[model samples]
Target: MSVRARTAIGAVIGATLLAVLPGCGGGTSTGDSGGNSHPKTLTYWASNQGASLEDDKAKLTPELQAFEKQTGITVKLEVVPWSDLLNRILGATSSGQGPDVLNIGNTWSASLQTTGALLPFDDQTFAKIGGKGRFQESALASTGASGKTPTAVPLYSLAYGLYYNKKMFADAGISKPPATWDELVQDGRRLTTGGRYGLAVEGANVSENVHHAFVFAKQHGADFFDASGNPTFTSPGAVEGVKQYVDFIARDKIAAAGNAEYDQNQSIQDFATGKAAMLLWQAAGPNLQKHGMKPDQYGVAPVPVQSGTPGPGQNIDSMVAGINMAVFKNSQNLDGALKFVQFMTSDAEQKKLNGAYGSIPPVKTAAQDPAFSNPELTVLRNTIATSAAPLPQVPKESQFEELVGGAIKDLLADAAAGRPVTTQSVQQRLAKAQQQM
Candidate 1:
């Protein structure tokens, strides 16, 4: 899926689907008496993950066929593009007409769950899927509001990493990738020369900007919110993190001048075309080949942390990010939907699907396949086990993305215009961002 499409899934939070669409009461399924015992047909809305909807269908058709054969159920699969999934879902959920099961970005789970538009995977419901213990603890934790039964279950898992061009590193005489932020800046300076840049940044994408800020801020011992779920964008640690990110272009001059307009795809293209040495991204493997970049030209590493800055925070990483699957509350075939969810989560299916998507399976055992133990995926595996966290599990996450993300975009714009971006100025922007929330 496109990065914007994936990130936009989380943007639906704080918007009222029920209020906007008339008489939308979820969790009101038809009381079909023979639900569990009989065979049924189900409708499923799957998000696009490959080159196109056709590619996604190619990967999933066989699996769905297998599911039908095994359970005596038929699944009508609809591959929804990321651009239209959220809106389609909103319209469906609000109007009481939607698919029985669907795929959503993991970050959107908490907010969507709050609407009661999806059925909660409580103890009993989980029994229909798999036991709760079948999932990774961190992955499972991201599926609902705090202290509530999750409305979804994890399907695929992913994490952020630094992707650096090996040839560029060799050209720059750097033998190793950076492990700390200071080293990154120093190496970035070395790699930057002539028409090439050291790092590729997605300054124009508000979602990408906020995700980067999330990573850097976490490394500096700050979070987007506090215990009470209030915005803390202007916090000392957050300010420092944002400054460091903006400094790549504003202060250090290692990033390209035109990067202020780059989105995630542009940055990825820059790295793929050898115009930039490094890019921070999640799941670039599938897209790399599509962009005509050879795998051997680049290598992946854990994103650098503020290791030199000793304190309570130093080596944190990104959220245990990935795709999640949920069954809607209003379905004619709720039993069939539940079975389909379980079929998707089964060990065999997890391995098959994740392998095809180049994603980690949320099931612990399924993730243990040799396919995921490669140099590229192993680092992500370790990161997920040790450092990953979900985006702030708050209802206002969409608002947070807009507010904090827009603030950073504004900073980048000012920097691109050769205007000053002082710490005090950043603080002011953040203050304004928080006010917008």
Candidate 2:
């Protein structure tokens, strides 16, 4: 997650929305028939969390087997790529043919809540899994719009960090990680020698672009939406924020020009292979290690700020990143689905699954496990608790990501092709996006 992303719902929002949330009334319940009888098998569409779909399946199979042994409920799993997850979920919502349970990017929680396709975690529903207090407040905050019942609860928690190759720094005589953007650019220059770049970015990844854009916007004191939920894409702060990020590739020249075409984890690959020195990513350590980059090879730090150390106020660094679990409102086996959710979020499962995936458990007890004591998890957990912010919970947030992120993607392309990326150019792109909204 990066609350992440690879999500949108503009065309899908009112497209045959089904049953409303629990306690909201006037819609179908989750059970197809008898509430007391449970299904023999449950379908789960898990988001791609490991090196590959096959890898995710391999990791989850044992857990699923254990679950079936204990509860007699077999889970049929499908690992969905980020590119297809949102549209797949939309198809389910529209056709009422979704899995019994699914993993959703936390960023989609509020937007998906509008469709009424998910079972709301209301008071009684919260009690079914555990208490509302069982999960961290930081992870819980992104579950849905404020003042509304959450449509889902956090399963795996993540936060962004500046992943730097430690050997590259030590060899370059850089003593510590940069604490501010200027220092980042400065350090980047020294490290950008001999064919390696200072930074790596997922320029074509819409969710990745939007996540970084959100962080920079916070540093510049820009909110993408007003209190009344109107889009504010071209505000001065917003333009500057977007520019600050694009400038890393454009003005700062820290990243490669070819990076503008990278949408997948190519940027991560670049960092892991030492083609780049720094990476701003969400819980990327395990993925890097999969590429043969060792824990001793790199270090994680809070994403840099404007001009000071990362903290509260303008220094807020990353967005709350993670996956959320949701049960389809019209699922055939509502009881089994709820049980599966309980099993997945249980303290034991949380520790096992989150530890394996290099994610911090949203469950407080699970996060406190010794497995999370490593430097990587420590930085991420602290960031989530102290510095990370959630994206706006507005219904149009996904649309905002699509439009603004696309605009930035184009801006990066232009910069990569030797075009100017001035404030005027940035605002023009955002203004067009605002009009689209």
Candidate 3:
């Protein structure tokens, strides 16, 4: 099942909601093994995608089998869909029956850390993953806790950029991909005709939808959080950025109708089916492959800059999107779990996994490997090099998503209905949401 369908089902099956808490016992043996001389078995939970979890298991299974042959440690792998991951982890953590190791969405690191269920990646742990210097600086920051310690190790990294269908651009009489904000808006207007939208963006849920808003805010010199991790979305730049987003649907009529009901899947489907000409989305190479598009059929570019911005270079904010691996604090097989994380993030393994799965490696050296041959991947790599920033790792991160996403959704709905979508109204709504945070 898709993540959205599973999330809808999970919401309906409310009885399965898992309770979250802080802390777990340091030394507990849930897996029938005694003290940690050598664990007989270890459990791993992986998030689902086409062949992602399965491919990782397939590639690593040999190593695992070799480890078993060499050291007598058996690894058990469970594939969990994204929707069920939090619930499963929460339930297991609460019952003291969680998997020994799990892959988590990078943004969830801080929230998951609040449960105190994760083992900290101290200096000793860093050495296991080829040292702290192996991973990208932003990826490292995404895994660490604010005012605390690093809670997880970034397993892979992804960033957002402008993806345009070459055919669509040609059909619209556009010569090249947009590089500046005005050009983007003008192209969007030109592309919106004959049942095709100019862009596909998240509009429904806060979690995914806020990604574009965050990027636009960055272009205008506003961020969701300041250096000290306080909410800072009330600035003029932020308001202008958000207003441009809302105006795409409301004023420009360059987005699909009922966008407020859209999510990642819907947006992706729209783009894939040629109903949209452009998409500002996180790395979707895997999805594009599944949809039968060749790399040559599309063009990827850095997000366009805001017009008249005073920055020395183009302002583009790209969200750090990927999964991280965290060992449960209570696991009896901490050493084994840590070893597995180390193996996964190793330069060799990173190249293998990312090459197979169409994801960028979290480790810097692996990303430069010849195996990652796509030009789009190169664009993404360059975007990360210059403009990538970690999402808010605050414990209240989810709340921020809800606030920003909700406000945007309301503004779009109002604008689509030919109602007012003023800067003051958006500012007020955001201010109220900030206060709640």
Candidate 4:
């Protein structure tokens, strides 16, 4: 089937069959009741991660109390696992039993927008959340529908970076992380020896693999889409970029063996256990804390640039990613749902929530807050401020990853097996995949 036809069919199925929950219309309101005197309660869904869901509930207890004292509306919060969140939301929305507010991965924005399950935030609502000027422009851009107004608000932001062990660098007599692509390769070679791999890239997880690959493609002056939003993966720059990453693991043999099966967990474990010297990852703070590695033990820096790149000192391509907040279209308390979304994205709330979780604030002012303290976080914040780029917002983005990403993996396997990976073959494979997408 044609890509558009497939996308259309998927949207129809998603919207028509997914379960959606009903919102509370008449209940003992404990928070801001707004102008209307009708009592109401708001249902919220959050992902369970660091800071126990129970603790998140506890943290919000005070805020809920204050909100209730002021407005008399009660907030009911439920924590969902990351694995089940998307499916649950999809089912809930289709069944008309969805929550008033829910969290979603930033990349899922376009897909969710297509379901028509979310309500767009107008200018007035934007103002309530600290206005357009408050958020990182790229993040806000990622929240909107391709040809329409924004469907959700960016709740938090994060970007991928090179995290290295301080002791490993020092032991190798390397005083600093690489500033250029060539230097990174040299460092990787030097670090790879005696049962330790030089780097851990998410080579197996197609979604993550493509995310980092796009960062490299950007540094090489290529993008997944052209000015008209058509797929552009056949570009010479993109092909070269993909080769560079594949070569690191295959030709150079500097990445962990069996990397083809490595997911985010494998990469994280390799880095945390010192089996790998460096990892390109997003928001490693929580994981580091869990592993007992403090700031002083690790160093964070932007991904290095190729030797000859245009427009910058080091052509850093910050891979930005995060979750957005959305309210279902069938929601009974539309105004109340919007208000809750507004509260979550508000500058004050962004600061509090991001601070609690070590996430980069989505808002410009919140990102600049002095209280946002963490050495690694500071590096990430600075990188996002000057170099971040959004992923392709195409509705078929997920499908493209599955298709082209599989081709890249095949190329990697070929190269690792000492088989030639020709540019012509790569181009043919990618072109075919583009047609499929």
Among these predicted structures, which one has the highest TM-score? 2
Colliding pairs, model 1:
319-389
Q: TM-score of each candidate? A: 0.91, 0.94, 0.87, 0.83
Regions more than 4 Å wrong, model 4: 1-39, 48-70, 91-95, 308-316, 409-425
For model 1, the stretches where C-alpha displacement exceeds 4 angstroms are 1-13, 17-39, 308-313
By lDDT, rank the candidates, best first.
2, 1, 3, 4
Q: Each model's C-alpha lDDT?
A: 0.79, 0.85, 0.72, 0.68
Task: Provide the lDDT at 255 for model 2.
Answer: 95
Q: Which of 2 and 4 is ahead in TM-score?
A: 2
Q: Write the per-residue lDDT of candidate 4 for residues 1-437, one digit (tens) a residue.
A: 00000011122223333333333222122234343343367777776544355766766667666666655667777777554566666666555556767776676676566566677667876776557677787687678556677777887787767899889999999999887778888898999999998888666566666776787788778877887768988898778777777777767777865776664366777888888898877777677766767768788887677764322322656666777777765555667776676677667877887777667788777777887756778777766667776677766564566676677777777766667767777777778877876
Candidate 3's TM-score reads: 0.87
Best by lDDT: 2
**Could you tell me the TM-score of candidate 2?**
0.94
Clashing pairs in 2: none
Model 2: residue 312 alpha-carbon error in angstroms: 2.3
After the best TM-score superposition of candidate 1, give how far the Cα of residue 408 lies from its true spot, in angstroms: 1.9
**lDDT (tens digit, per residue) of candidate 2 on 1-437:** 43324333334433333332322211122334444234677888899888777988999999999999999887888888877787777767765666889998888888788877789899999999888989999999899988999988899999999999999999999999999999999999999989899999989887788889999998998878999889998888889999999999899999999999887789889999999999998888888998999999999998999986777777889988899998886777778888999999999999999988889999998899889989989999999999988888887676777888889999999999999999999999999989987
